[model samples]
Target: MRRFAPLALSAAALITTLVQAAPAVAAGSVPGGGHPAGGHRTEVLELVARQTQTTFIDHGDPGTSQGDELVLAGDLLRGPALFGRFGEVCTLTRVGPEPDSFDQQCVGTLTLPGGDLTLQGLVSVTAAGPGEVTVAITGGTGRYRTAHGVIEAVNTSETETRLTLRIIL
Candidate 1:
């Protein structure tokens, strides 16, 4: 232990120096919280969704086979205020029985005031309808140009879906 003291001290000093040189990454501020430059932060967005339109496109065998697509569009709300809109395209990737037996590849977008956030992932389809999915934020446009994160989407009803976003730049 005696011989290891100086080496341990040097290692601790190096670690301290590295931590001091690293950038500060506190959780991001809210929308009005002034977007700081080059900060690794998380911006949270909570919105209620009202699905306005949906369509099914049959491919190949004209049934619920692979490549069948479901397209959905909706309005987004914060409380009673309608602030944005969203659209999603889901393609059947696997077909099986009900509940957890089916999966669909989904790509979606959130059209907000300043920009749009895109997402892609697999959504599990049940006999009732499309369930919930956590998707990767594939990039964005305008103010969200540098955006990349995850979105949690739940289909609360046939006409409603809820969304929560963790956006990082």
Candidate 2:
């Protein structure tokens, strides 16, 4: 069991590295297409988030669960500001008859006070365990830019729950 701990820790570290590195590929562009009206774009200067009630457990049996809320407020280059406050309730269940295995599910809502932005999403445990989870956004409208495409500022929301993504971008 002790030997497995080192392996598990290594695997978890690798997963975290991969997730953090993926976002550096492209930091510009919207999802759908086109730039903001009049070519005015808002650049995300900094993001500060405070998450409470977030819980984590090692495995099944005697595991613990908790509920918390999060508040994230950030600044944009333009006059628009971004802020999101959401409550999260999640459970981590040890994966059946298997050691070092667990699953987690989190459902929450994100809201932006300055702009027409809102998000209703669920993040679930995946791959290795609770450390790795997939996020699915259901309904919301906001502006996001990436190298792949430009998501215009519109009332667009996920209808069919799109694809299972490992990152919450």
Candidate 3:
């Protein structure tokens, strides 16, 4: 019992030191409050998109019409994925938005040998006054089939066009 006295006292002092060193939780501040630990605060905006019936003139020929219904899910600041038939297996990374335009990098796997392809472009928001924004993808490249095709044909053309996208945030 006599020998245990100093040991117990030392243990109590160590506990006191630890308690003093422990970080205090602020009032009304819960664990992991406001934002998640190490997680970026993201604002997700959903947009209902409609492409024009006009096909890209540079791709094949004029009057070649192809329309796509896209569901764009992304952070307003950070670009999002354009999901739909057109976005079956692709991911779009939003770089930043200019004064009236937003930039994005579209990356996806090719269907043939299935190599990776990246298309960088910008979308100009013509109107963002209301709950919706009308945007037009100015231009982008469509480079694909590089893994299986020849080097000459591997380089596909890119275009900037006038297509209206109705974004519903």
Candidate 4:
């Protein structure tokens, strides 16, 4: 049951609920990689986000699930890319009785100039004291088709969240 909860949280609810509204990619736009071939490159995109909305859906009763929905608009703070946005709707299922630890999948869409990139991944929040979470970019669309990277989100304030994406490939 321990492994099953986290697996279900990741597989069943995360992808379908997180990704929402995104603009279409423009034709003839260049791909996300703005680098020359034949070497590994690490690109960092800093995004400043303001929480647009949030909804707490479940309280995590013994037989029930726990989770919430988060929406935010992120502006490019530093990077070659332009503006972006994402919406996360997910539920909380714990691996154990750890108060600060839980397993959940967040579904969200990362919209960029080229087009709307579907963001799907599993987030394992080991601690909850600080609202900081790390996510793995499992897959996406358009220029990000083969995209994989690490995203770190830190809450600066009640309504502000700082996101840094160390994107590779």
Which digits, one per residue and each the tens of the lDDT, describe model 2 over residues 56-87?
Answer: 33333343322322222222111122234343
In terms of lDDT, which candidate is stronger, 1 or 2?
1
Please give, for residues 5-52, the per-residue lDDT of candidate 1 as tens digits. Answer: 110000000000011111112224454334466456678776665666
Model 4 scores worst on lDDT over the 10 consecutive residues at 8-17
Clashes of each: 0, 12, 3, 7
Report the Cα lDDT for residue 76, model 1. 69
List RMSD in Å for every model shown: 18.3, 11.7, 28.3, 9.1
lDDT of 4 by residue, 62-155 (tens): 4324543333333433233446656555555444466455566566666655555444555555443223466666666776666677666655
Show where candidate 3 strays beyond 4 Å.
1-85, 88-118, 128-144, 147-169
Provide the global lDDT of candidate 1 against the true structure. Answer: 0.58
Better of 3 and 4 by TM-score: 4
Q: What TM value does model 1 have?
A: 0.72
lDDT of each: 0.58, 0.26, 0.17, 0.46
Off-target runs (Cα >4 Å) in candidate 1 are: 1-38, 97-100, 126-131
My TM-score estimates for the predictions, one after another, are 0.72, 0.37, 0.17, 0.57
- Candidate 1 at 61: error in angstroms? 2.0
**lDDT, residue 60, candidate 1:** 87
Clash pairs detected, candidate 3: 79-94, 138-160, 139-160
**Which candidate ranks first by TM-score, i.e. highest?**
1
